[model samples]
Target: MNIRHYFDLCVEAGGQVFERIGLTDDYRASRGTGFFTAEHHIRYYAETRVGEEVSVYVRGVDRSDKVVHMVALLVNDTTRRLSCTLEIAAIHVDLRTRSAAPFAADVATAIDRELAADTADWPVPVCGAMGIRR
Candidate 1:
């Protein structure tokens, strides 16, 4: 319905990556924890309309003790063009504690595997300060 919704859709697709890495529904429910989006950047290259089918693809970019960086693309299925790009920095946190936490060893290993396997190449948006220039 909106630009934000498009980005959210892409993030949801990205979650499939997490699901495969052991962050299953049961695991999240039992552990009472999961990764949360700490920050995101979305750049739109074109507009999409309702009823148009779009595919989202995500790849692991990097990771640290507290966060995983990922890139996702929303593509127009019919036209085969990228609609937008989303860069996300997600953090693992203890839901109860509401604090940053390291990913479980197995989870970390799985993330590393995805990071290594990600061979997707796309143009990254320029990131820095935003401003109105003369």
Candidate 2:
């Protein structure tokens, strides 16, 4: 298994869940912008072997108009344990300007809904120095 693929999977899963308003292809195309990962931290709790069945669960944790916090869990189904957790902070970007940009109204509303609806049983493992820049 490509371990790094987990991060990509997490991003893809999040994009799909928020595709209606969060960083969708239409948004990128129409707005000429997209989301860029600003920070990433992973905490490993257990080893997930190649043959082990693992599920990737990703959810929004919080958001601002320009940034969003998300967490992804890699669960070892065979062992019924969490293999790892990924914390990601991503920013909306302007493709043309190459700078942070605010999300559209609909996107912000969708992010708000996701943040409100998302829940977790465990605390997210985050690095001390990473987050949306003030």
Q: Number of the top candidate by TM-score?
A: 2
**Residue 66, candidate 2: alpha-carbon lDDT:** 92
Off by over 4 Å in 2: 18-22
Give the alpha carbon lDDT tens digit for every residue of 4-38 in model 2. 76656666666666575556677788889898888
Worst 10 residues of 2 by lDDT: 1-10
Tell me the lDDT of candidate 1: 0.79
Residue 87's lDDT in candidate 1: 82
Worst 10 residues of 1 by lDDT: 125-134
TM-score of model number 1 = 0.83
What are the runs in model 1 whose C-alpha is more than 4 Å off? 121-134
Cα TM-score of candidate 2 = 0.84
